[model samples]
Target: MVTIEYIVDLVNKHNVWRGKECINLVASENVMSPLAKRLYVSDFMHRYNEHFEKSHYQGTKYCMEIEGFVKRIFGERFNTDKVEPRPLSGGQANLIVLAALTSPGDTIISVGLTSGAHVSHTKFGVVGVLRLEEKVAVNNEDLTIDVDATARLIREKNPKVIILGRSLVLFPEPIKELREEIGWDIPILYDVAHVFGLIYAGKFQEPFEDGADIITTSTHKTFPGPQGGMIIAKKDFPDKLWEKIYYTTFPGLVYNHHIHRLPALVVTALEMNAYGEEYATQIIKNAKKLAEELYDRGLKVLCADRGFTETHQILVDVRDYGGGAKVAEILEDNNIIVTKVALPWDTPKDATENPSGIRIGVQEMTRYGMKEEHMVTLAEFFDRILNRRENVRREVTVFRKNFQKVHYCFNNI
Candidate 1:
C-alpha cells in the first residue's frame, strides 16, 4: 500500500537528517565531492562494459575511455601500471586477489577479527569462500601485530600469502620488518582500505616501498570517492601473476563491472592529486586531537601512549559507559554517528553483542572543515552525552549546521 511519493519522501528525509544534522564519525563512510557526485549519475550507469577492453555490447567507447583514464590516473598516482579499478567492493577486491594467488586448501596468514581485520580476510568471508585455511598472526600488548611471533608463525605455517593491514589500524603496519623476516618469496597483500588517502598523500607508510607485493583498497573510506575498490601491484610483480589477477577479476569474479563510477572516481583522483596532502594531514591531526581530548575527559582511548593514532580513526573503550551498542545508540540520538566495534580483548562471540569499543573517524568531518579546535568541542559533546546523560541533540545539530560545505575539493573556494 506504499506509494512512490512515500518512498521519495523517506529518502529525502534521510538525506537531510543524516547529511545535514548528524556529526558523522562512521569510519567507513565518506561524501564525494560536488563534481564527483555530479558525474556519478550518468549514462554509463545504464551501459555494460565487460572484460577490460573486450566490451560485451556496443556504444561503450566512452565508458572504455573513462575507465582507461581512471586506471591511468591511479597508475600515475601509485607509481604502477598494474592497477585494476573494476572490483565492485573492497571485499571483492580481496576475493579477486585470493583467487589469483592461492589455491583451494592453501593456508594464509592475516590479523584476527578481534584484532581489527576486515571480515573479508577471515575464514567466514573470501578465505572460506575459496576453501582456504586461515591462520592468524599474534598481536602485541599495544594492539599492533607482534612481528616476531608472526615471523615464527610464518616459518611454521608456511602460509601461501601474508595479509597486512587492519580495520582498527592506528599506526602503520611493520611491513618492512615483516618482509625482512618472511623473506621475498611469499606474497604480501596489504589492504590499504582505511588509510588510502594517507597513503596517497604520503602521510602514511608506503606499502609498495616497504615490499608489499600487492595492495587492495576501497576508494571511498579515506579517499573520498565513490563506493568501489581498486587493486595495485608492485612494478616488479611477475606478469604471470598479473595474468592470474586479470583472469580472476574478469571471468572469475565480476561479469559486468560497475562502469558509472569511473568518471566520478577520476574526478576524485584529480581532487586527491590536488588537495590530498592538506586534507590527509588535517584528518590525522583531528583524529589525534579528538582522541587526546576524549582520553583527557576520562575515556579509555586506545594507543594514548602511541599518540592515539596516525590515521583518521580513533578507538575508545566504552564498556564502562554502558557498552558500545548502548553508547552508540545514545550518541546517534544526539545527532552523532559512530559505530560500535569489538576491541582486541573481546572474543568473537562477545564481539557480536555487547562489544567494548566505539570507532570514530575524523576524515569526513575534516572534509566538512572541522579542525583540531572543533575536535575539542566534539569531545565535550561526547562528555555531555555519555557522562552527564544530557540531551544535546539540538546543540549538536546547530554545531553541524556550520559545516555543510565540503572542503579540500576543486569546487570549494
Candidate 2:
C-alpha cells in the first residue's frame, strides 16, 4: 500500500512549486490567504465535527461558534436571510439544495454541460437524487442564455425545479425573466459558484430579487474563502427545508466536517466585505482586457464580438489549434494554466474528447495584482508561442521574471 506520509510530503512539495511558478488561469481555482491556509492545516486538520452541536457531536461548542461566525459572514456579505456553512464542497451544497427542494424522480431543468453548467446539476452527478430531465443552451451569436429557449423547454417539460447559473458566466443570468415565465410555484435554484464574489460586489445578477428559491455556492471561487460551500435561503424560511440540509449532511451523507475552514472562511468573508466590490470590478475589467487582447492577437474568444465578458471568465475557441486540450497543453508549456471546456452547444462526447473551447479567468491573477497592461503583455506571450516566434522560452522567462518582480503573491506582501 502507498504510505500516507509519503503522499503528504509529495503534496507539500507540489504546493511549494505550484506557488512559485505558473500563472493560474483556471476558472475554479484560487489562492487562499496565508492566514486561511494556516487555519486549514492546523488543529482543524486533526479534529472533525459531525453534528450541529444542538444534536449529537461531542466537543462542538467551539465548532458551532466558528460555524455560526461563518454563516453570519456569508449572510452579511450576500445580504441573504440565512446561510448554512457546513457543506463539504460546492457540489455537496448544490446536492443538499436539490434534495431539500425536490424529491426523487422530480424533474430539474438546467443548462446543458456544454453550456457551462456543472455536473452536479445534471443526471451525471445528482441524477440519483435530482433526475435532471431537461437542459437548455445559449444563442450561438452572443453566447448568452436563451431565456426564450429555456421558457419553451420549461413549458414543454415542466420540470419541478429550474436551476439558473453556470460555470462560465460572462454576464448576469436571466433570472428576472425566467421566474416570470415559470411563476412562483417551482423552485428556482441559483448555483452561483463562479460569480458569488462578483454578485456580492454588485457586478452580477441579483438572485433573491429575481425570485430564486435557494442559492448555492463554493466559498473559494469569487468569495475568496477557503475551500467549502454554503446554502442560502430567503427570510421567512421553513424549518423543515433547513432540516433536509441538516439531516442529509449529518448522518445521511458527509461526516468529519472541517470546523477550522469555517473560521478561515469567516476571515476571508470579512476581507470580502471590505474589498469585494473593487476586487470584483477589477477582475471583470482584467477579464475583458485579456480576452480582447487575446482576440486581437489572433485567438478566437467566445463573445468577442459582443464584448469579451462582464464577469471574470472568458471562453476562447481553440479548435484551430487542435482543440482545447491541445491549446491548453501548449499554453501550459509556457507556464500559463487554463482548462478545456465545451461550448454551450457541443455534445457530451466532444466535451470529453475534443472540446472546442478553453476557459480562462482573471480572478486569481487579479488577486495577484495584475491589471490590463499585464493582460496585454500576457497576450503577447501567447503570440510568441502560438505564432512560433524565435527564442520563445527565453522571452517568456524574461517576461515572467518581470511580472513576478511586481510582488503579486499574497505571501510576498
Candidate 3:
C-alpha cells in the first residue's frame, strides 16, 4: 500500500530527524545556505542544457549565462581561467580527468584506500571502469604519502599520471616536492574534494601554485554548494589536455549537466568569496580543538604530534572500543554521526566490515557556527558515549537544536 503520502511522510521525517535532531559529522557532506537551497529548486530543474557552449536546447540562454558566470567566479577565485563546473560528482570529475589524461591499460599512481585514498582513485572504481592500472603510492608513518618513495616509484614505473590528495587528509601533500622530483613534464592532478572549502577559503595549501597541473573536486563536501563536481586547470597546462577533458566531459560522459544547481553553486562560490577565510579558519580551529579535547579525554585521536589536523577532518583509532563499525553505530544511536574509516594498517577486508578508525569532519558544524568551546562540548559527548557508555541522544538533540541555522552565507536573502 505504498502511496505518495507515504513517500512524502518519509521525506518529512528525514528532514526533521536528520536535519534538526542529529549532529552531523560526515566528512563528505554539507548543508547549503538558506538562499542557496531556495535557489536550488528552480525552473532550470525541469529544463535541459547540452554542451558547454550555446545549448543545443532552446530557452537555455539564462542557463548559459549562469553556467558562464559560475565558471568565471571559480576561475577568479582559484586564479585560473580554465574551469569546468559540469561533472555530476567528484567521482565523475575524476572519471573525466582520467579519460582525458590516460588511455586504457595506462598506469597511474594514487594513494591507496588503506592510506586514505577515495575509492574513485583505486582499481575498484572509475580506474577499473576505464581499464586503467592503479599503482598505490607509499605512505609514511603519519599516513601521508611518502614523497621520496612516491618519487622513486614514479621514476621506476613511469606512470602516465600522478594523482595527489586523500579522503582522510590531515597534512598537506608534498605536491611541490613530488613535482620537483618528477619534473614539469608529468601531469599531477590533485583531487581536492574533501578539502575544497578549506582551499577556497585559503586555509589549506594552494595546489595550483604547488605544481598541481589540474584540480578536481565536488562542489559539496566542505565547499557547501549543492551536490556537483568541478575541474580547474593551470592556465599553462597543455591545450590538448584541456581539449580532451572538454570532450570527455560532454559527448563522452554527461548529457544534461544538471543545470538547476548552477545558480546555487554560483551563490555558494560568491559566499565563499565573501566569508570563506573566516569560515575556513574557524573550521580548522574547531577540528583541532575537537581532536585535542578528544585526545585529552583519552581517545586515540590520530596525528596528535601534528596538531590533530590542518583541515576540517579528524581521525581516531576506535578499534580499542569494539572497532569502528560498532563505535560508529553507537555514536549514531546517540545522535552523533561519523563514518567508519580504514586506517593505514587496515587490510582491504577490514576497510569494509570492521575498520579500525572513525573519521569526523568539523566543517559542517563550523558552518553551523560551532566554535572551539562547542568543539569541547562535542568531544565531551563522544567521551560520554564511548568511554562512559552513556546514552546522550536527548542531550545531543537539544545541543544540535541551537545550531540549526547555517552561517557563512548571505542569510538575509
Candidate 4:
C-alpha cells in the first residue's frame, strides 16, 4: 500500500525544493487539482473491457459509474452531443478523429510546425507518419492562422478536413470565416489540446458554436486533470463515427485506460464546473499582466498592440538574449522555467539549438495561486537576467534556493 508519509516526502524532495520556482510557461501545461490527483492515484485496475461494458466483467459497475460521470460532466461543460474519454493521449484523440473522418489519401489543412500547429495534424508528425495528405502554413501578421490564405488554399486544394488550434496559438483563428468560405462541404476539426479547458472555463472562443464539427483535447492542460485525451463531436455525426472512436480507443489502440485516472477525470470536470471560470479568468489576467510587464520593460513580445494574448501564454522574441536556448538557459539559472519556441515562419536556422524566441505563461503558477502581481515580479526577474546576464547569475542562485518553499504537485514533486 501507499503511505502519505512517503508521498509527502516525495513531494517535498521533488516538487517544492526550489524558490520562486516552477513558473512553467509552457502553454500546454497546468498543475492538476488535488482532487484530480486523488482520482489518478486511486483508480481501479481492469482487464480489456473492449466496449463500454454491458457487463463485460462482473465488477465493472463502479467503473461504469465513474466513466458515465466523466461523460456527463464533459457533455454538460462542452455541451457536445457525444464524448469519448478513452484516448491514451491528445495525439491519439486526433488520430482516431482523423481515421474516422478522412481516408489515407484525403487532404487535410493545418498549420505548419514553425507556425505553432500540432504534430498530430502536420505531415511531420503522426499525420505524416500515418501517410495522410496535409497542407500546413502560418498567418502573415498577428501570428495566428491566416483565413484569407486558408480560403485560397481551400479553394484550390479542397481538403476534406481542416484542423485548427496549433500548439502556440494565442489569438483566435478564422474558423467562422473559414466555415463560411467552405460551406460545410468540408468538415473542420479543432485540435484544442491547449485551449479546451479555457473554453470550458469561458476563457476561449467556442469552436463548436463558431462552426467546428469536432474538437480534440488533452484532459490535463488547462483543464487541470489527469493526463488523458478526449474527443467531442457535434450531434450530427452518425453512430459509426463514435463506434470507430470506441474501437480505436480500446482494441484498435489502447487496451485499458488508467482506471484510477477516471476518478480524477470526473473530479476535474467538477472542479472545472465550479472554480473553472474564476481560475480561467485569472489565468488570462496573469498572462496579460506578464506580457504587458515584459513589453513595458522594452522586450519584443508578440501581439502587443493586439493584446499580446487572450489566453494564458505569451511568446517573446528573445533574439537579443542571444536566441531562445540561451535565454531559456539564463532564465533557468534564476529558477524561472520557460521554453524556446520556433516562430511559424522560422526554419532550420531557428531550431531550438538556436531558436528565435522564448515562450512563457502563468498556467502552472496560476494553479499554484499566483496572480498578476506575481507575474510582474517574475518578469522583473527575467528583465534583470536579460539585461544583466552575468551579474544576475549569483543573485539568481539565492532566488532559486527560495523557490523550494512553495508547494506544487501532491506527489512525485
Candidate 5:
C-alpha cells in the first residue's frame, strides 16, 4: 500500500535532483532566496484577501497593508504610481489588461512566434479565448523587431494595442524607435515576463521610457519573486483606463490573487532592489560568455555578430544535434535542464513539439553564483553531451554541488 510518505518522498526526490544536482538552464525559471522560501510557508496560505478598493470579507487588514506596500515599492522603482499585484499569473495580468482595453473581436499586433512572442499574445492562447484578432509585426534578420516595417504595418492595421517583449529574447525590442515612427495614438503593452528583474536593475530597456503605456510580467522569472504576476502603468496613464484595468482584475479576472505568496513576493521585491544590478550584470556576462563559448565550439549559437546576447537568454539552433526536442532530452538526461523553442525558420505548428532551437538562460544559475568562468565549464558540458555524444550527469552534478547556495539576495547579506 502506498503511504502519505510517498508524496513527501517524491518532493524530497525532486529537491535533491533538481535543487541540488541538476544545472537548470530553463529560461523561465528561478529559485527564490532562502528568506523568501523560508517565509513562504506561512499562515497566509490558508486565507484570502480578495479586494479592489474594499475587501469582500474581514481578516485582510494586514494583507491589504502588505499588498499596498509592495505595490508602492514597485511603483517607485519602475517610475509609476500604478502597479497592480492582484493577478495570479503573468498570463492573467495580460488577459486583464487586454480585456480592459479592448472589446471582443478587436485587432491587436504582436511579434510572431519566430520572433519570440509568447503564446498568450497569439491566437493559440489568450487572444483566441478572448476573441481578439492578432496580427504579426515584422521582424528583422537578427530576430529583433523591424521598426520601419512595423510602423508601416501599424499604420495600415491601426491595431488596438501593440504588445512587445518576447519569450526567446536576445536583444532589446525597438520600443522607442517604433513609437517615434508610428506616433503616439496606439498604446503599447510590453510583456517583460522574461526581463522584469533586468528592467528593475536598469540593465535593459525602460518600458515606460521607451513609450510603453503599460507592462505585464511574472514576478518569478528574472525578478526572482514568488510565482505571481503584476501589471504596472506609466505615470501619465489615464485615470479612467487605469480604473478599467483595476476593475478587470477584481470582478473580471482575479479573485484571491494568491495572498499566500504576498509575503514571499514582498521579500523578493526587496531582494531584487538590493542586488538586482549586480545580479543582472553577472547574468548578462554569463550569457554572453556561454554563447561565445558555444559558438566557438561549433554550436549554432544565434546572433554571433551582435555578441550573441544582451540579457540572460541564449538561443541555440540545435537542428544539427537532432532538433530542440532531442537536444533538450539529451541535455536533461545529462542533468542539464533546458526548454525547446522554435527558431525563425520553424512554423508555428512545429513550436510545441520539435522545434529547431533550444533557449538557455543563466539567471537562475547566476543566482546560484555561477559566473563567466563557470559558463565556460557549462559550455563544455553542452558540447560534450550534444556534440561528442557523452553522458555528463555525474560531471554536472559534481559541478552543481559547489554552487548550491542562492546568491545576490538578502540570504548572504
Candidate 6:
C-alpha cells in the first residue's frame, strides 16, 4: 500500500488543496516568496556549518560567507552589532537566552498564557525545563500588561529578567512605562515572534528605544522567511553575555543550524527593507477592516473600543456559535482556515477545548495579494458560516483562485 508514488501524490494533493484553494488565516504562518523559496532549495541544505569560537567543519567557504553576511546585515538592520543567527525556532531562541542568562531556580516574569504569552515564556514550557520560577505580569482587560502594577510587581519580585510580547498580541507592550519604573538593571526580552516584520518595517514599536534590551524572534511569521530564529541585542550589549550566547547557540544548542535557511533569510530581509512598510500597513488595515466588517455582521469581534487591533491579528469571541472548537472546525470544513485560542476569561476546561475565541490573521492572505476589499468578502463568508450556518467552500476556493501571487516583494517585480 505504501510507495514513493503514493507519498508524492499526497504532497501534490496537499499543495492543490491548501495552496491553491484554502484561504489560509493561520496567525503564525506565512509563505516564502517565489524568489526566497527558489533559493531555499539550495545546495547548502546538504552541508553543515557547526562552529563555536571556530568552525568544526570544512568545505564551507560559501556557507561561512552566507552565514557571516546574514549575521552582519541583520545586525545593521536591527541597529545592533550583536546577533545570534542560530536557534532553529523562536522557542529555541528563548531557551538559549534563558540558559545563557539565568541559572536554575532563578525567577523570570512573563505574561500569563491565558493573557496571550507564548508557551516558552510560561512555566509550562522552557522556564520549567530550566528549573526557573516564572511569575506573570498583571494583564489588563484588553489583554495588555497592566504597566503600573507590573512595575510594582517587578520591584517586589526582583526577577532576573522579564519577558514581554505575546502570541495573541494586539497593542504594543508598555515597555517604556515598565522601563521608567524598573530602570536599566534588569533585561527585558521582547519576543517579537509574531511582529518582527512590522517592527522591521518601522511600522510597530521600537524595541531598544522603548527600553527593551533584547529581542528573540521567529523569522517566518510575518517575516516571510524560512523557518528559523534569531536573538538580537543593542550595539553595546554586554560583550561577555554576547559571547556566552554565541557559544550557547553553536555547540550548546544546534550544530548544523540549518545553514539552508540563511540564504532565504537574507533574501527576505532585503525584500522587507525594500517594501515592508507597505506590506505591514496593508496587513493592519486588512485586520481592522475585517474586524469592523465582522462586527457589523454581528460577530463579537473583541477590543472594538480600541479600534480592534494595532497588529495583524483580531480575535472573535465565538462562544455563541457553538464555542471556538466547533466554530474553527466548521470554518475549516468550508476551507476558511484559522486557529482557536483562549481568551483572558477562559476556564481551564475551555482553554484546552471550546475556548472563547477564534484568532484571524491577515498577514498570510496579505502576502498572497489579498487586500481590504477582499477582507469585506471574507467577513461576508464568516457571516454566512457562523451567523447563517451555510457552507461556502466552493465560493471560498473560487475566491482564492484570484490571489495566488505573493505581493509586496520582488516576485515578478
Query: Using Cα atoms with residue i matched to residue i, what is each candidate's TM-score against the true structure?
Result: 0.99, 0.91, 0.99, 0.89, 0.98, 0.98
What's the true lDDT of residue 190 in model 4?
87
Off by over 4 Å in 5: none
Q: What's the lDDT of the predicted structure labeled candidate 1?
A: 0.92
Per-residue lDDT of model 5, residues 1-413, tens digit only: 88899989999999999999999999999999999998888888889877768889799888888888888899889778899998888999899999999988889999977788988999888887889999999988778988898899999999999999889888888899998899899899999999998999999999989899999999899889899899999999999999999999988889877787888888888888888899999999999999999999999999999999999999999889889999899899999999998988897678777899999999999999998999999999988887789999999999999999999888654
Per-residue lDDT over 117-211 for candidate 3, one digit per residue giving the tens place of the 0 to 100 score: 88989899888898999999988868788888889998998989888898998989999888888898779999999999999888889999999
Q: What is the lDDT of residue 181 in candidate 1?
A: 88
Each prediction's whole-model lDDT (CA)? 0.92, 0.76, 0.92, 0.76, 0.91, 0.91
Model 5, position 10, has a per-residue lDDT of 93
Model 6's C-alpha root-mean-square deviation from the true structure amounts to: 1.0
Candidate 6 stretches greater than 4 Å from native: none
User: Superposing every Cα of model 1 onto the true structure, what RMSD results?
Assistant: 1.0
Candidate 4 TM-score, true structure as reference:
0.89
Question: What stretches of model 4 exceed 4 Å from their correct place?
Answer: 1-12, 18-20, 43-49, 53-55, 390-413
Query: Candidate 6: lDDT of 139?
Result: 87
- Report RMSD for candidate 2: 2.9
Q: After superposition, how far is residue 50 of candidate 1 from its true place, in Å?
A: 0.3
Off by over 4 Å in 3: none
Error of 5 at 311 (Å): 0.6
The 10 consecutive residues of candidate 2 with the worst lDDT sum are 404-413
Per-residue CA lDDT of candidate 2, range 1-413, in tens? 88999999999877644554677788887877766666677666667687654737566677778877876766776576478777879899888777766777677787767677788887788744465455554443455567787777787777777877879788777788877776777777889999988887778878788788788899888778788888887764567777776677767667777777876787677667667778888899999999988898898888866788988898888888888888888887777788988886578798899899899987987887788899998888877777664235445555555444221223432
Q: Is candidate 4 or candidate 6 better by TM-score?
A: 6
Error of 5 at 364 (Å): 0.6
* Alpha carbon deviation, residue 227, candidate 4 (Å): 0.7
